[model samples]
Target chain A: MKARDLMRRDLTSVEPDTLVHEAVYIMEQSGLSTLPVVDEEGKLVGIITEHDLIQAALPEYFEMLHSVTFLPNLNQIQKRLKEMAFKPVSEYMKEVFSVHLDDEDLHIADLLIRKRLKQIPVVDGEGHLVGVIRRIDILSRLIR
Target chain B: MILTVTLNPTLDKFYWVEKLPLSLERVEEEILIRAYKSWGSAGGKGINVSVFLACMGVETVAMGFLAGHTGQIILRDLLEKGVTANFVWIEGENRTNVTIIEKGKEYHPVKIHEEGPRIPTHAQELFLKKYRRMLKRAEYVVLAGAIPPGIPETAYRELALEAKEAGVKAVVHAGRRALWEAVKTGPFFVKPDVREELVVGDMPVRTEEEIISAGKKAIEYGCSACLISHHVTGDILITPEGIWEYEIGVPPTAFKNLVGADDALVGGIIYKLLQGEEIPEAVRYGMAAGAASLEVEAKMCLSPAAIEQEMKSIKMEFKEPL
Candidate 1:
């Protein structure tokens, strides 16, 4: 199948300056882990994933824990959650490893499988937002 | 904190061949066999979940029966992976699950499962005793997979009861009698494939819509969550909160093998759950993990980096009730 056939036409995106909490909420509500980062012009600039948000939310002291521990440190957890609620997508969105709209669906699948990616943003020649290709969307084609 | 019991585990052997002809006298050689050495782990449903929980940095203990050379290998692998195991040594060899992949064809991997060790009555008693002792410390107990020939199907029900007595959350991942019996006790989770649901619940699960309905019904049967792993349609997760659907995308490269995809899915779900993700989020992680496992060489662990990357893009949606 072609990229246009597999990609979702309705785009859910976030501006580069959008708050991290808003991005997280969008992902949680839409059941999406990544969001395309767009500029004020609605042009694709980068992408953000749950992992980025997780790493951003990790406290400096988390790496020092050696034993199995529950999420007992509510103060630290809340502080990180608050930070994610305030920071902008521009601070954490990955600049590299994105796809364009003209790219073939197979090409997008290649990127997903090769890079082990979950979602790839599809943009126009001038970098305007167009669509999004997700792993499940591509996998659904296999059933057919 | 989590305990998984595996009775018959093995090192999966995967053979890849390109374009399998329906009936050929002597096909030319294009077959490639990749063997992955897995840790000494329990070979059933509970054990698989424990392996993943350990990988996700959870304090997990695995208990079950092991025997012969393959049994020893399972132990070695689990120890190396840092998973604590308390298995009863029995007589006989662990069985291997084989996958023959016909290249160029979609979903053409043929899986052949070997019968595992025969547990003597004495060993069975020992296992039950050990499990009872272990249940005291377990926060969650996952009873997974098929029972060996000599074992009664009611074994899972008894275990579930014991877990319930200890105030531990029990998750059952089996079919037929075991699944039906577990449901009476109200398990934390029940994951049945469509065929199993059809046989056990007498429900039609031909399409995605039917599967979702059946899954909801399973939840109504006292399970906290119902997960259906479809052969072609991916997976559907149904919880009291809502229903979520996850579909797999074709990998960039042609699929090499799908031998451990379901196990990988189980692993992914446990991994996410340990990370404190909700049921829906855990299912997405499981789907990505299952899909990623299809691209791996053999019985190896699904790449964590790959899963993390896939987690970023995998899409899931709540299914509106029809």
Candidate 2:
């Protein structure tokens, strides 16, 4: 199967000026975990995922402060979260991944495995958001 | 004059694209999207209230800590909306909020907030100093939104108290921690989300009865009135005299890409209250404004004439305070 045949035509996306906090709300409301970040011209600039947001919201030293001597500061983490509350998603979205409409499903799935991406956006030749294909969409290809 | 204190403000941008993919497995990673449309406007709780107030023909002033290029954009937009502003200059840039709406039948709406710049101690003082001067001439003062870092939770309380002492009614909408402090100052009114009871008040208010009981305690602390907004179930209004339940009768007309519905509610209430309308009438006006915002694609308020028509469908039931 090719990406065009397997990819779902519907896509979730946001603008560069969109806040990361509101992105979380959209994901939760829509029950989707990923969103493509587009610029004013509708060009796909980056992609944001649940992991990207959670990691960005956390304090920089969150994983490193497990020691009892200097425990993780709740106040610092709260401050980080509050700060993230007003930040735009353009700051942390991944710009490296995207797929062409005619790309083969095998290549797309291989890229998903290599990058550990949950969703890959399908775009037309003009870089317009057309659809999306997730990891499971092509799993049937391997099974059969 | 109505003074809106948005300690932190942002540029709100909206982008319309396609319907969201529900299942993760259904989509590919990279997609180019042709943005059908995009828009930007004023954001921040107090700023939104000011925008709505201006739409209702009220003279409103927006105040807050602003800095950098993003702040300038917000200031320019505020002026475009006919709201005068005097923001305290601070270091770093202001934040931007993005709202993404999918254009299909679902009308999926996703919002993202940027982590705003932190205000320095000196900048905080400058803002408060401005607050002191403006409170003296203000007829109504609105305190709203999340308290930015380095600013104490008591910030709203202090502002609200200043308004009260000046014989101006203060309306505050904030989270639990700030709400607790603000209620003690006894602004004319306090409106916290229904979930706030668990976060800031003495009880968890899921049902109507619980909301009234918890809201009463908040009112008795300092304010003359309180409102609890439950977006889906509707809202509850309480005062020392009695309590009332507001039924929008229908959901917000436009849910997608609709921001500031709550702020419009706050603005509508203040508009009617300043005109000497009763609490129930004011509450109705608030509901209509909120409903009007639901259908709009941008973060703009409905005109009073339009809201007046929507107000007819709102039903209010006065449940005597328990």
Give the C-alpha miss distance for residue B6 in model 1, angstroms.
1.9
| lDDT (tens digit, per residue) of candidate 2 on B112-138 | 888788877856764665566667668
Candidate 1 deviation (Cα RMSD): 20.9
Runs in model 2 deviating more than 4 A are A1-144, B22-28, B31-34, B104-108, B194-202, B231-233, B252-254
- What's each prediction's TM-score? 0.61, 0.66
Per-residue lDDT over A10-105 for candidate 2, one digit per residue giving the tens place of the 0 to 100 score: 434666777777677556544568988765444678898887876776655656874334635567656777788678888888775889988987
Model 1 compared with the native: what TM-score?
A: 0.61
lDDT of 1 by residue, B1-322 (tens): 7888665566555566654455655677654444332222334566666666667777677777766677667666675565666566666677877666666653566767787777788668757765776676678887877777678878888888899888888877777777767777777877763433564456666677777777777777677888876555367778888877777775535455555567677777776776789878888888887777666655435468887776665668887642
Off by over 4 Å in 1: A1-144, B17-44, B194-200, B231-233, B251-253
Candidate 2 — what's its lDDT? 0.75
